[model samples]
Target: MMLPSKTVLVFSLFLLLNGILPSTTVAAARTTIGFTYSAVPSNSPSPEHVVAALQSLNIPAVRLLNPSPTLIRAFSYSNISLLLTVPNHLVTSFADNRSSATLWLYNNVLPFHPRARISLISVGADVITAAGDSGSDPTTAIVTAMQNLHHALIDLGIRTVSVSTTFSFINVITTAFPPSSAEFQEPVNSLVIKPVLEFLEETNSSLLMNVYPYNVYKLHGEIPISFALFEEGPFNFRDDVVTGVRYHNLFDMMVDSVIAAMAVSGYENVPLILTETGWPSNDEHMNVEESKMYAERYLQGLISHLKSGLGTPLRKEGAAETYIYQLFDDENESNSRRNNSLISDGDTMQQHWGVMYNNLTMKYNIHFDNADQISTVLGLLVPSMYFLWLLYDFRLAGILLVLVYFHSRKSEGLDTKITFITCQIFTSRFISGLLIDIDDYFCAFGAAKTHVSRSAFLVSTMLIFSVA
Candidate 1:
């Protein structure tokens, strides 16, 4: 039982070398997760509470339907990334003139940037749905507004910013069952989708899509509930004749549907970010347990997908960042109004979707036992180690200075000689290659030499001219 002091010291050193020490080593890895906020219609919870709740959950981003001064101010000091959207009604006006777009950005966006961490500017909300509406030809206006806003942002030196519109049901290619052969409906694509895709491709902005697999399951009762919810079992449906891709869960099927549509429109390379996807915790027809199970499964699958760094069946290696539909269920905007059939009157489960309840208590424990140990180690070691590394590099930097001095002196003499020789050769070559006839032997010989020994001769000529 009596271990030697040296032996213990050696064991401790081994553990530290192998990264077994409980010292914090901060990794620069961060996930940009976001939630959508709607401040109008119903007085939603205050941004303070939202920010506090999201901060506690380690979420680093948020997308707002409309930018509110109160919300922006509340989150001013926080490091959360904000993606603000212009309302559907405001799109036409904003698109009509550069002045309007400039005013909007100046008033709403610029005031909060570098402080509130605003990153993306979505121009319009659900243009696909607006286009499908009976009496609204809002698509063209909205797209034009988005284009104007994008140019305005660029003019203002907002190079890292992105501008795009979000699309809902009408933009999706939902029919192809196995998921790969899915294509957008012709009428919708021709009028609204194609132009949007073209703009997104040209601007290098992501195509934001709101995909809810919960809707697919609710609408089509034939698909097994377990399969739709991503339960651990073999799916009954395995094959598709169209694209020949096998799908076990609704999420993959849904993603593949979008990919298929993008490929059809020749916009397959454009990034597709899931702007919204979440399950309602309450529904009368659907089992409450099933709703919870679906939510848990969906989040787990999403986290795994992000960590895996893989894309859907169609885009097997592309950016696949997603934003879960909401942070909390909006009772006023749920079910009938938003076509969210997952919420119901009798069950209070909709309100329970809050990872932290109204009282700010965590709904369920997110198991981070494995990460906790790593986090602890990282917290203790990274800062000290980084400083030590910096100091060590700084002390050795004199070597770089000495090397530069010698290099400069050596280059001086050779450079002048190179310059003279290179200038003479360049002048001779130019005269032969351009002014002299191809029939002349000297011109033909010069052209042949230039073509055959192009790379080597150019390098030599440049060095000679520079030295001379």
Candidate 2:
């Protein structure tokens, strides 16, 4: 279907803004959804009020992209899980000096861990990714900073906090179709992706992927909107001949693309966590009704999908732990049109990527409790000793292991599930080169059998062990 013309689109926008149109979303099962909390002025809510607001809204977790003690303090004593960030520009200094990392933690996270629910420390932003940040490959800087800061966290006895970094999906994925055929491009794959995956594997950390299906639909109009929205799609299904997995939504495809890329790169069991994903809205670009519909449908669908515990088509046992792109809009950033280089729609959207207005008013319709309340056990991951290498905290992984172990045992017999999950997902050579008894694990498995069943056990095993 061709997109609506400018006239109709404009009229629609007008009506929605005038409140003639309403934003509506279907009910969906709850999932763990957080939002990006950009810094606001001190006393804007006096920190205490902001924390109260977040709790009252039932926000499960929050990712603070910018370093804001005030915001962190606001979340302190609140139940919300906090994912703090390290600026990209600081990657160099943090990587170079252990003291720099320590100092950062002392200020940002030391005073607040269990109290603030400091869950993860993202190493850097994607802003510096395009040119490698300050002339050095920012990915490398990220790796180093993550390693050192992890040590700092450990030294500080902050065991619950994991270290990770964000990567743009477009930067890593080379092909997305047919799902199974996905792989990462060179230089990025070898230089960035491979190392990053290895670091995550060793650390028992997830590759924080920032995916924007909204951008995909906007840029590639041929793709169905439902594909991006996580809603029941117009296509409904796309099959991968090799994987034999049928994809119902664009999110699983995009996510599994990274999984496939990791599998191809010899690190089959690398885990994933979503650091950013959301739709945008603005009066000039789209109407309030349209904007509300975008958030409602997309989020409701995503919440239901995640809570289904079906995982993705490819990794049935793995769940996506996702954080929404933003809470409230940033006025200054939104207003900056970059000298009017962007077209009308793009300009409108540029400043309007928020669930609420910067003034803390709801821009669209959504229930805070449904989007928050983070403990949604949608899927369990297979264990890998190597995957668990750098992570000293094994409680979370241990729980998943037990759940998946029992789940597997109840179904396809223990031997096959554990063996396949561990070895099949591993690269051919890695499996071909394991120290254990291969036949005892594989039995008389025919080529006809699919390989996802036992991957959990093996990945968990790798996660437990540290690789040199």
Candidate 3:
């Protein structure tokens, strides 16, 4: 007995759909890449222009260092998630008074929340760096502020936005070379990070850290420039002697270092978000490493690696969210002596870490939403191809459908079912073609060559049975 052709077609279609749908959806749940926007006085683009630019580039999220009411309102109905930051200057005030946090939210969040899609509230940006200026315990201020903000949100009956603070890797992590041996820097780890980690774990929030491969490369001259720029090669890798894990890029090595530090702190499950990571296109000194070419390469490579769905060596799932350091170049900051160290090639250099210009034009050609675009095109294309085929002949239509199905499955690493279904399609086509030619052969040969038709029929029967 043989299976019906309709049943075979249905079964093949079922398997084909099951195989292709999951691969297409993998990009949806992968790490989200966004941009960090800090408005510079008298130099920043308008909120409408900024929002329009982000939407034009298909960027899905943004971290606003200066979340003014007007700027926050611009993101309304944009479908771009906003990560709002409370300046370091306000941390102490927010911590000392819960009403301050509530008042801040009412001004910044209450009006445009669900419309703007506000996602996370970072209490402070690198609070440790500003500890000396504030004359207060940085750790205490961060944790208390976060608690006040969390409570404030609850009081407002809003639960969607999470609270956390950001830290710079170079300022906090003690070691990063052999990522497995990495740990948070001493007093801050004990005094500040531990309690912060505990709060994050209890609330199910993420720890935000600024991971800069360029800084790490500058600090350690032994690291090759290619490794920092995300260029893949056999020599670009660094092995963690303790964990026996091979890191192909500096970004992953730095991220895994944070993961190792978190694990040592007994809060391994808390999610990690990279609040800042980017290469500068140019600097005041015009350093060789800070060229637009290198910047473009770094941005493109980083996006590709994250979208590839290959997480860090330690944590299979990479940073839950990552924001490129900035959206527009700050001409003023390029001249400032911020974080210019003796190790930075013996010169005070601050790179312009913006992907775009103040004029709202892109500085680097990087595709932020390529995966989504490809998925969209294929979603429409597959159906359109079938519709066109339906207007043609069914035999040719079946062949085209099978070819498309095979190609899609092949991209996902084809398995036995795909190969079998492909063979079934061709075999069914072969049998149909043979049956159509049998009448011509019978008329030309007459009753004397009836065995010729019989043999062909038997062969077609065997092929159909084999497919079944």
TM-score of each: 0.66, 0.67, 0.72
> What is the model-wide C-alpha lDDT for candidate 3?
0.77
- The residue-level lDDT of candidate 1 at 62 comes to 81
Q: In candidate 1, what residue range of length 10 has the lowest lDDT sum?
A: 20-29
Over 307-373, each residue of candidate 1 has an lDDT whose tens digit, in order, gives 3434555676433456765655556654323433333355432433434455555444443233435
lDDT of 3 by residue, 44-107 (tens): 8888998998898878889998789988988999999989999878999999999999999999
Number of colliding residue pairs in model 3: 0
TM-score of model number 1: 0.66
**Which residue segments of model 2 deviate by more than 4 Å?**
1-31, 40-46, 127-136, 284-290, 334-349, 368-468
Would you list the C-alpha lDDT of every candidate in the order shown?
Answer: 0.61, 0.62, 0.77
lDDT of 1: 0.61
Error of 1 at 347 (Å): 10
Best candidate (score: TM-score): 3
Report the C-alpha lDDT of model 2 over 368-453, residue by residue, as the tens digit: 44423432221111123223321322343344346545656666544443434433223222332231213222321212223343
